[model samples]
Target: MPVITSRDHPLVKQLIKLEGSAQYRKKTGLTLLDGINLIQIYCSILGKPENLIVSESYYEDADNKHFIDIIFGHKPPKITIISNSLFRAISPVKTPIGILALISIPALKEQAYSRKVVFSVLLEAIQDPGNLGSILRSAAAAGVNNIYLSKHCTDAWSPKTLRAGMGAHFFLHIHENSDLKHIAQQFKGTVIATSIQASKNLFEISLVGPTAFIFGNEGAGLSKEMIQAADENIVIPMPGKTESLNAAAAAAICFFEKVRQERDSILSSNIGTK
Candidate 1:
């Protein structure tokens, strides 16, 4: 294991660049996975990370030796041990977990909506990394395989988003920098968007078929073009005094409602077949 002492080391500088700049991440096709959980997830879903950076403390700590052994088992990648301070310098979180993995972003193909989907999500201009991550997590939990994002959305692979997403990035096929209007108009299935004034109720509708849900920016909400392009503008009714829902909360509710509807549909189909 190589020990990187200086913050100015080429590898250290590269990790900083990858964390600090989305453009750099895009240019290099590289991103940092913070913590052991993310690194383990990347290893399981994709493969072993290209490089693993460990804090010197972890290297010296007798108790954690087995953890490191688990990481490098058999086919280990390049390993570098740095001082706790130097490790923290490259860490995205304030409380450093003493480990990181450098890996190429999985190349998820961005293609047009050719066939109808059982479930898909289109996100428009979501700027908050946390919100975007939560939405992605929810989408994955709901069994959504495909997601499209507008150009203005936050970088999905950023450490904050990745942490917030909590490994959803590995499961999801994310298409970034998409044309929202074009996708909304071109989508073959039921394109649904939440609107306060809409007469349609979200639970009343059928989400069993090819359905795509559109969620908009946190503050500005959906663009007029996207809403206009959608096949249906439905609203999640809140009889309570809460005037509005947080973007992440709303997304989760919308996603799981589809899950519920689909479950019911499957049961009904099974009964009919019997």
Candidate 2:
């Protein structure tokens, strides 16, 4: 592994730009994946990273040597060992993980919708990176087929969002910079919009078939255009005095309900066949 002690190294300068500026990330089509788990997941799903960076201390440690060897068991890519200070400078978190990878952003096709996408979540104007990541995680866990983010939503590849996603990015099909109104119009199945004032309860609706769930900003909720474009407007029944749920929490509830309903349907079909 090559050693990099200077913060002014060309690679270090490039990483700093990618970490600090979303525009730079888009321009270069690259992003950073910090932490060992995230890197491992990326390698497993997408293949080798363009560059693997490790702090000097981490590289020298005998305890971590075996783990590193296992990570590179297949064809390894370029590896660099940098000084701790330089690693900290490039790290986004307060406490550096001592390892990270510079990787190309996965390119997704610009299709209206795929036939395999029976269930999806559309986010509109969700400004919080953490919330967006959590929503993505929930969507992936609930077996969602696709995720659509409005142009105003937070960047999906941002470091904070990637950290919060906990590797869900590798498992799901995500489309960012999308126009929710146009997608809603083009959708062939039910488009369900969540609202605080909607009369119908979420459980009362059928989520067993093709459906898209639209969630909006934390404070403002779904926009008028989004709500108006939906085939059905429903609200999660909250008996508690609390007025609402956070966007992520509400999305989790809606997604899992769909999962539960689908699972029950499958079981009922098997029983009928028997």
Candidate 3:
């Protein structure tokens, strides 16, 4: 109910701690949500936040007021309205969204293998949060039902990543600390790994039924251990003098190729039935 204008407020300090320290985020089991859209989505899926950081400037916005009334009228989360200067200090981005919330880390879904067509994304040691987030967004958009993040991958709930993902986390199943080989076997799909040196082009590969597409790190690409574990390794064709595509770009291509193939398969089936 009250505004927190001082930079020294305890809640402000907590946010400062979260912004700088990943360990703190992990320990607290809470991470920062920068944009209003993300916060809104998180709330819809996960319920009320423990606290909300609002900008003094937009605290009275009509739309925001209506949203607050509907979602938080009875028992709102602790709203800590801060001055523009102090809000900037706690926000990760340059332009603060005037709305940020502390959200609990989502629980991972149990791994399953029953779906006839399942696509899971494997980010092998991807260091950049933005890239990983974009890939997750693409994976969800391309109809991948699940995502498997290696232990070495970036934090899926980090602020930067959550923003880039644009709320893709809610729509897809995510598994961390996963074993690709075992996952591949369980899904009974072609365990395809993406690599530049592979002789097989992705287009030529028969990506039908269940398939798991493994996308490696941005710099070193797939670890030799992961590559050795894969049932099939393929490469996307490159026509440019550019050495190769970025990891996110490569992933989009491979994922959509699978989508294309699946669509064609369905169309053929319909034609035969007719």
Candidate 4:
């Protein structure tokens, strides 16, 4: 095929349009995975890209060539090698990786919705994409099995959020605009909602069974409806006078505490068995 030399090329414009809108990606059923690392993650999760765009100069390099060959080893997609300047035009990052892929977004399978999900992150009208992305990265680290985002939450598929999340998006089961109360009802375990003013301390609370954490937006915090919907309200004890911790920071603390407790429990059991 011919090289796409112009920034206004139809495919380039289409990919750029997906930069801001999740709706466009949903409608088109195509999501842009920027940079080599993210594209590699995409390949690992979603299979070979339907199409690959690369900078011509980088494509000629032996190292990049080998990496591209590895990625395309299974069944190579149509590759569009363009000039450096043109690649920069399409890239969203400051230091463009000069590589990107447009891949099909996998449909959420029936198995993804489970009544026995151990841990999940709940986003209530979180507007900032960075915070949402950071929370996702933290959640993935802390072993969260799913993420439930309210209708008003930031677009998880947007470019900025995707970049911040790195490759966390692939591993997460994200359900958008889901009913918080109904989902919580399905989960028999504890429902913990975090806030600054809550009477109970986070560490003191038992993270025993399946648990869901509700973290609200930075400015508004958890809404009354979300708080009421939760089974228990808890707070991360702060000895200092800091009014509130960042939403993402607070989430990391809660999630890791659960992980630590579970890990210690397993170790204690093994020691007793011995």
TM-score, one value per model: 0.93, 0.93, 0.90, 0.90
Model 4 Cα lDDT, one tens digit per residue, 160-247: 6776788788888889888876777677678888876688888887786688999888998988877887888998888897767888
lDDT of 1 by residue, 106-163 (tens): 9986656553446889999999999999999999888887899999999998888998
What lDDT tens digits, residue by residue, belong to model 2 across residues 62-81?
86667777987856778789
lDDT of 2: 0.88
What pairs collide in candidate 3? none
Sort order, lDDT high to low: 2, 1, 3, 4
| Candidate 3 Cα errors over 4 Å, as ranges | 70-76, 111-115, 181-187
Top candidate (lDDT): 2
lDDT of 2 at 229: 93
* Model 3 lDDT per residue over 1-274, tens place: 4667887888899888877776788789888888778877887888888778888876868887677778776888888788887888788778886888887877777767565687777767888988888888888898888888888888877888888888888778878777765666676667889887788889898987888888888989988877776788898877888768877888888888998999999999999999
Error of 1 at 97 (Å): 0.4
Candidate 1 lowest-lDDT run of ten = 109-118
What's the CA RMSD for each of the models? 2.3, 2.1, 2.2, 2.4
